[model samples]
Target: MRRNGNSDRLSPIRVYEWMPVEALNTLLKQLEKEKRSLENQVKYSALRLEQESKDYHKTSRERCTYLAERSQVSGSYQVSKRQQMDQLPRMKENLVKTGRCNSVNQKTMNAMRGPVKKISRSNHLPKLNL
Candidate 1:
């Protein structure tokens, strides 16, 4: 006959079986502490993921805004350049007219000087000399 609580399968495997109740309580507390630590780590990881997602979205929005602004600036620059190009021919025509006026004035001055010189030379010649 097997002794009570002494069966081969029912026998204690480790010394904890003979440990005080306080020691078991301490072990239970340690397991709870480890469980809480694991839970906190999971929470922190989840929060980090959420924060990263938000940051990514914000950065994407900022990038889109920057691109839009750049496009607008480029468009304005192109329009202004086109306007300037369109006005260039008129500006060139005005410049040509001013140059022509200056040339005409120079020619008039040269022609006036030639006649005055001729008259002065004629006056200085002998009265009877042809």
Candidate 2:
């Protein structure tokens, strides 16, 4: 046999008559306390999320700054290296002109060797019989 839904369900007045006032009051207070606790948890969770977002953004900015500085340093080093490489041919030409790699120039050789002193030669008269 199918049960009647209306007969199975208790009306508000019947429920109130069955449950004592003290029990209903206690249940209401417990529910209110739980609601307040849940609200506080929600607020704490929101604040924690906001703080984590701020920390994430701060670290991201710091990382970007570090990468930019590293790239600039690397770029500067590359430029300096390129400049030195570009001067290679000119340095070779200078070496060739200075005769350091080929026949040496007397002036340049003398300047590189420092000052030279000349010794005076004096002949003393000595007769030897052959």
Candidate 3:
């Protein structure tokens, strides 16, 4: 009995049985090769991602340390007396009259112009004749 052209309606089992055994084996080998190749690509990408993540973390840590050191260097200079001040201009003026605000800068003249005392031992201690 000759069937009409309806090969697309064949069942999966019928389709496999219709193909030659050597053709099926060749297809299987090709599919396995593709699977191995894909697996190797996946491994390569994973390793690369891990290496990049490590580098990112290391750079982040180094950046944080560098910023901290820089802040320490700049913070060493006292810009203000404290976090807050209790008095206004009136109190500040009184403090200046009492010689309390001598450390604060209100004049344009240099503060380091004060006389520099000699650092020799004679100025520190009384000269005792041995």
Considering every candidate listed, which one attains the maximal lDDT? 2
Off by over 4 Å in 1: 1-23, 100-130
Tens digits of per-residue lDDT for model 1, 52-115: 9999999999999999999999999999999999998888778767864334445456665552
Each prediction's TM-score against the native?
0.56, 0.58, 0.49
Query: Root-mean-square deviation of each candidate, in angstroms?
Result: 13.7, 12.1, 11.5
C-alpha lDDT score of every prediction, in listed order:
0.82, 0.83, 0.77
Give the TM-score comparing model 2 with the true structure, all chains together. 0.58
RMSD of 3: 11.5
On TM-score, the candidate that comes out on top is 2
The candidate, 1 or 3, that scores higher on lDDT is: 1
